[model samples]
Target: MSRTQSIQPLIASRSAAHRAARSRIVSLVLAIACLAALVFSISGGEYSITPAKVVQILFGGGEGLENTIIWQWRMPRAAAALIFGAGLAVSGAVFQSLTRNPLGSPDIIGFSTGAYTGALLALTVAGGGFALTSFGALLGGLLTALLVYLLAWRNGTAGFRLILVGIGVSAALASFNHYLVLRAELDVAMAAAVWGAGSLNGVTWAGVIPVSIVVILALLGVLIGSKSLQMLQMGDDLASALGMRVERAKLVLVVLAVLLIAAVTALAGPIAFVALVSPQLARRLVGSGSLNLIPTALTGAFLLAFGDLLAQRLFAPIQLPVGVVTVCIGGAYLVYLLNRGTQKIRS
Candidate 1:
């Protein structure tokens, strides 16, 4: 009300605007990086094509081997990496915001493990078809989420409690997955192991199309509810005071995030740590207290695409799963994070 008080509020407003502008710039840079990674991924295989040639092929100018490699192979794999990365990152951001914990990522909190369990079960018992595997993954992830929530709920879910319960559930599910894999025939077990390692190899347009649609829809859902998510991050009492239905909003957020995680896992075989690391990296880049969904998604796309590129080229003719690369990187990051001390949920 006083002049000094009014000036202080104006200063805060200016600072907020400056931070928002910086965040937008960072997001744009990340988007460009992701695009560059996609191009590199598409053009960097054994029979290398230049970016110009890749573009030419996309524009229907190239033919024969170039056409088959770019259109039939590289494009689908690149597309899968991009979409799956974005989905996982957005899912991670939503869960982290919902739980107010840095470790609340889908991978860390049992969703990935649960999806893996489901896929393994489908492969071993249900004879391993795409539709059945996807269904199993979704069902498994959702059930694990429900179990974690129930275990963590005394009156309402707390971030630390949920994380603890999720870790336990994840451990149990990991054992279950191993058991299923061991029970399968040798060929089936080998195939399941390969899938579990999360290769982007052999992705065809048929698989990519449905995955793209699902990722797009799930991402739109996250964006639509982004405002509620932001409010929810300010603690349940404040969010309720601001006229948000905290519980309902949280439930919706959880469902959307789970759908994203489960869908990506079904498509990509529980690709490790993109969901966990991307959002954290994006937050560090933007220096934002609130979630930056677009930046997170872009960071994820870049990581996955780049990782896939490395996986393909690093061993030359002996391609590794993209998950192996990511796990190596993410595991190092996790160690660094632990050394930096645990970040607790903000009240």
Candidate 2:
């Protein structure tokens, strides 16, 4: 065989090997995510169920209320965490890809703040039920994102300008939420506050079903548009040069991210940081510089699932909000990232 032909075959073989390696890495990550889910599903709070028992209960081979406990109660919480994590991670990946900035997650962009505001309004002003509250959160989140987009449109969006505008909007919304909490009746405010702290403590399977349906559908939507999203990351000029509709793709991703963020926010309250950190973490784990949405989503599932477990299990009788644990850890990481970024800029 000619050297040229031989070299081409070798290159193709190496490329195939690389792809296989990445596939294996993804498989490992997903397997770990499952184990984490199983571990957390049974090992929390006063019940102290074993993973084996939990598995049996889940699959319909258990004696006693272990079945009910796992199926009705813990299952919902565990499912919520998994769905919440995956949604946030995917949303973060979407935002980061579109904005071409690491700090471009929906929470960072003030979308979550908007959702929280809507939820607060529902709870306090509207006196709405759970369904209404969920709708309100969805409305608030989508509206905030739209408003930010409008305000940030000055001829066109520069990535950094969009980020700055979003940060400003998010900060304002946070302040407004605080004011709303203070102004509401004590019981109402307390309810809102406790929920705002971010717990999966009481989420039933009913709640889980709705949130899961929404998250799964929206994730499927994002994946369907993945090619467009990848093209989007190449920047407007290049994407346009390549015959891709830059604005349309960005709009789709923005809407998808908003939907994912709103869905989880409605179900779990504003849990903070999963969306911010998970995609970055996933990328590092998978050794991909680009968005690996599936792996990132799985990584998110693991992070939130385990965090919920720790919050519920570690405290004995006192059940901390799953959100509280993530925020504490996420907060520390955020500070570290900011400080590191600042130091690099200064140096």
Candidate 3:
């Protein structure tokens, strides 16, 4: 081989190493930012605790009221925001990778709405306990995803078709959800409406614990399957030629992503747009074609924790849902994406 060819390999190696290092640095910075957001979230609510006191309570050093407030209230809310946000972000990254479209997020399509539909059914028809609602959300999301996937698969799954089908399914599910809520008793409808708004106001350990566990497991599956997911982005033929079981891999990743979506939806209602925005934002920040998951997850956690904090303190006495803030931000981002004119969806 020529000297130039030898040098090309070295150049490629150096470039890859540089990207890896940059990804790590970005992830570290995002992690620090997430911690700062968490601290602020825990310290800034109605019964305000100082940062030092919040730290003290976190470390098992504070007295009764401080301990009760932080441990009982703030911690659970913050934890839910972080955990749920991370799950949403990772799910976004997976779909975006699979579809090769920035707009291919769960909320953008139909999974979140489907999950909401399921939760509404559990509430209106089944008397809406937490466990039943969670199961319902999971079932709804899975069913919606399956429907969209099958509808989109003409010859094979095309990214653009999947998105369009998802959008249609989401509209239909949203309509069905409203009908269910409307037909329910006044008290039940009111309760479902509150949940549908995706508030973290009354989040507790009971909700947070199960969600955290499921999210963590799903995230682990994502991490393990991430390589195959990236390969799928290269096109199905190429991925198959490279010895991947493309269909099976796609199915696994989709299931995992749906689980993340369902678990969060069950606990916090259909908090929108984190899944739509986080991965793209992280990709931009890291300047990587295949962005690392850690930075995306950390960015998501910070967005949500900070959003929840704003929700709590923005109005002081009356708290808004975190979903409201995310919708505003995500809506703005969506408009920007549209204005920039995203490439046509792949057929």
Give the Cα-based TM-score of candidate 1 against the true structure.
0.95
lDDT of 1 by residue, 78-191 (tens): 989988999998999998898898788899989889988887888899997888998898988898998898889988888888899999999999888888989899999999
- Candidate 3: misplaced stretches above 4 Å? 342-347
Taking the tens digit of each residue's C-alpha lDDT, what string does model 2 give over 175-228? 999999999999999989998887787989878898789989999999999998
- Each candidate's lDDT (Cα)? 0.88, 0.84, 0.90
What TM-score does structure 2 among the candidates reach?
A: 0.93
Off by over 4 Å in 2: 1-20
The TM-score of predicted model 3 comes to 0.96
As for TM-score, the candidate ahead, 1 or 2, is 1
Question: TM-score per candidate, in order?
Answer: 0.95, 0.93, 0.96
Model 2 clash tally, residue pairs: 0
Candidate with better lDDT, 1 vs 3:
3
Worst 10 residues of 3 by lDDT: 338-347
Query: Model 3, 15-111: lDDT tens per residue?
Result: 9998888888988988888878888888986577788877777877988888888888788998899999999999999998888998999999999
Winning candidate number (lDDT)? 3
